[model samples]
Target chain A: MIKTYLGIDVGSISTKGVLITENREIIAHAYLRTQGQPIEAIKNLIKELFKDNKNIEIKGVGTTGSARRLAGVIVGADVIKNEIITHAVAATYFYPETRTIIEIGGQDSKIILLKDSVPVDFAMNTVCAAGTGSFLEHQAIRLGIPIEEFGDYALRAKKAATIAGRCTVFAESDMIHKTQLGIPIEEIIRGLCEAIVRNYLGTVAKGKDIQPLILFQGGVAANIGVKTAFERALGIEVIVPQHFLIMGAIGAAFIAQDYTQKTKSTKFIGENLLDINFKTKTFECRDCTNFCEVIETYKNTQIIDRYGDRCGKWSEKLPNII
Target chain B: MKVAFPYLGYDTIALKKFVELLGAESCLGPPLTARTLSLGTKYSPELICLPFKITLGNFIEALEAGADTLLMAAGARKCRFGYYHYLQENILKKIDNRHCFYAISQYTPYEFFFKKMPQIFGVTPQKVIYATWLLLHYSALIDYFRKLIRLTRAYNFYDAQKKELEALRIIENVSSFKEVQKAKKELRKIFSPIINTSNEIIRIGLVGEIYLMLEPFANYEIEKELGKLGVLVVSKRSLYRHLKHLLKLDLFDLRTISNAYKYLKDSPGGEAIKTVGEAHIFAKKNIDGIIHIYPFTCMPENIAYEALQKLARDYEIPILSISIDEHTSKTGLLTRLEAFVEVVKRKKFKG
Candidate 1:
């Protein structure tokens, strides 16, 4: 019987899952909107993936993304990884020679530099949204172009109108001014795409020495206009992999595979985790100078995980509780 | 008279020469140890930066080692560092280690060598200056040779530096700037091409708390250790750069000077901000890495670190945050440094 490893990446906007077989082939995958409840989103994902095959046993599970710890606790993940490592693993797996990863999601953008499939330098933007998917989505709404039509409209434009892209505020104002000039919608869309690439280069990708074999992923990978815009700005080919949107999930699955192979024991909590009633509680522990606010996760009166403590005061108490 | 300096991050290999020139019996507190940290924490304010605590610890340890006179570097400028001498002096007085203190103030090092130290200790300025000059010459010679060797080739330059500096510290009868310059020339000529190579290096700037930056043991021999990986490190206390900034702050009123200057105009504390601001410029020039060193309780650096993080974010430069205290492990800092350098190297390769 072929055992599959499950990987879950829960972002603020989306939840992604990938089931990889023993040989690292994608057996089943799911990409769904998170809609704010990560636990419910993951549960729905699990249900959807298992609907067709109930006999497929999950040998290992890994979680990544912003809500990784939460998702880890929810799905009984065997390993947890950060965005940089997870993304780099997946990108390296896809493009073995990938030297750079330019990932632009809805809320954030990250630039990971790799040398021979290993990550060496990396930077991420958490403050601004000028070069991310949300910026394009907002513009698509303003232009009355269906979000799905954004890339095609940009491809139709012959020229791009110069627009300020320092931030969403400046970009929006510039877009309105360009629109008032009666510029063609396609040109404006093209300009927006170009502006996004320009903003990313000038800001988050600034000072970094970017090399070839670049892999651009994230939800925005669906936008061909952005891809074209990046190529024009960088003067290099940008490769968007087939599993761009679910790369993080794929990376998580890869990590799980690596971990499970190293440690023969399966620490998975089994599918019964789906039926477990999990609850959370928060309290302040002022035992030291650092008054840490610790949160405890309970599975029907039994504590399972503890976090949010600056010191390990509360979490240290968990083993005894368990 | 026996004199001692608290080994904060300043290149003590250089200071040892200065001490020899003064004909002073000198000893450095062991490269900031856990015991030193405990002593400092026991006596100092909890909120004060870790560097200050470690320094106070070093001072106490030196005093216990029978040091009667301490060479305290005094700065009366904008940053809290300006008050370090006064605060330390007062605290030491309270602790009653009232041994005599010789201050290296805003006055030139020559003034201290020729007049101030002699006036305070009743030694002839000429003899003291002569001895001091010889010590400084050899010290500078050692430093020049070490830097030359380290910068040029791929070898354990630290061992070479320590060996050369140790040799320089033994020479006597050095006086006057010209003699020191001559000694440097001789040392450089002998070590030139041999020290200078084909090493693909990324020069990194280590800026932040004095303790973590100076003590390789505290930060786990970070700079020298990184050198093992073919990375060149530029710390804030470099003589040429620190002097240039100090002179600019004094002679010409430059716009966008260090914020510490606002508080400690003619003091060591002011140099803290100047050093940080200078580092930002180095980062702009695209230094491979900038590790902002700070102690767990450092207030000024906390403010500076926050601002620097934003700058790094906007500039898209990689920065590793290293916060050290008594509880810090060498292994932990090493892990982060390796991870950070690895990331930076990877980025550069891709670029």
Candidate 2:
């Protein structure tokens, strides 16, 4: 039987999963909108992956992204990691000489500086979505353009107009003002792309050394316009990996592979778990002033996992099952 | 007289005990909560630093709780903290005419011990001297336990938390100097089992504004968050060390102040000088990184932050400077901490 590893990255805006072989070849993958229901997204993702490969034996499983803890419990993952570590591992795996990794996802963006294939420094945007993928998507919709064609519009611009990128609200207003002055849509799009790159470099990557072999990955990397903006700003070619959208998931899978090889066993429940009825309910625990929102997961009306409590009052009770 | 003071993390208990020992009924305001912050912000000047607002709220709450006498620590430095007591007293007087306010100047330890405390509480100088000694020992015990908690929580989260609660209970119950010594021995026993001596643990130094460094609520319990991330935290600012410096008994403070000379030629008021000095010390000690936290709109720590940035660049160590306000979210702070820990760990691995 061929051994395979599974990785799931359940983010706020999207859920991504990948299935890989022993030789790190991705056999099947799925990307779906989370839409506030991560359990359903993971179920559909696993079903889609299973449909592509029949004879593969699941060796190990891992989960990453914002909802990694919830996804880890649902999938019984062997390794649960954060997005920063997973992204760094995945970036280094593909591009061994990658010195800096710039990841702009749906709600957040981060810059990870690496030395000798090891991450030496990193910074994440704090409570700001000024230059993230979601911001670009919003601008594309406002311009009545599909997000997929955003890059093409930028590429067609004769000269990129300068827009204030310090604040999201300011940038949006500036874009509207430029449009009112009869600026071309392509130039406006190019300006927005450049604004994003400028915001990212000034805010997230500030004061950090940016060396050669820079890799850009995340959901936003599909936009070649932003890639070109980054290249133009840094005066160095920016390489976007083949699995840009699913690099976090792929990195999680690699982590699972490493973990299971040492432990010699897999904690994955089974491929047949797609049929299980999983439901999540949340309630505010007012035991203290923190008022932590506790989330409980039930499988067929039986409590399987409980989490999200700052104090492990409810979660610690069912340690046997989790 | 029923005396009250603002809560400064678990150090409030030590202060409470000191006041009680001085023959005054120590009525501490309710442990600082969101309600306290809201009450503070509602009445305080909007532009003032967070410590002023929160402590003002604490005084108001204590006054409402029928405590007639309020003791506020007065900052005599060039920072705005020097005026916090004057403003807080004026505000509290408007709420109640019968309330008594005492501002203990930090610069004049002799006046605080020999004259001001005696005049306010009607205690003899001999008794005041003994009480001050006991207060010093109590604060030291609390500081020592805080260090132990920071270290133990990194390796064993649940056990460390349990032990911390137990230690706090023991410290709070101590009524005399001998009891303080007993509590210290008991804390060592409680913390020893959970302490793991792993060389792989990342060590981070914490510096910045005194109140934010000492009060977990002000900085959203950053030390606890770092501890949970398996990082050994060494925080230099504490009431005990402040007392030691005031009494001219602290050798380390002298070293830290001198170390600041490399970055800052002289003190920038408040704890900024110490902040820069400690960052230099941590860099020299080969600590992995430094976490600098201060209240929003704080001037002194802001100066320290600029100097820290230069030090970080020169020392080749990462520094995470977090400016906290009432609006700072726990999830956001945790994410920054997690990312910083990952960066430090990776850097350590490369070495």
- Compose the digit string of candidate 1's lDDT tens values, residues B315-334: 66777656676666543454
Worst 10 residues of 1 chain B by lDDT: B247-256
lDDT of 2 by residue, B202-316 (tens): 9999999989888887888888778878899987888899889988999998899899998898887898999999999999999999998888888988888778878987887
Highest TM-score among the candidates is held by which one?
2
Model 2 misplaced stretches (Cα beyond 4 Å): A320-322, B43-48, B76-78, B86-98, B124-129, B194-200, B349-351
lDDT assessment of candidate 1: 0.70
The candidates' interface RMSDs, in order, read 8.3, 2.6
Candidate 2 residue B306 C-alpha distance from true site, Å = 3.9
- Which candidate gets the maximum lDDT versus the true structure? 2
TM-score of chain B of 2: 0.97
- Chain A superposition TM-score per model: 0.92, 0.95
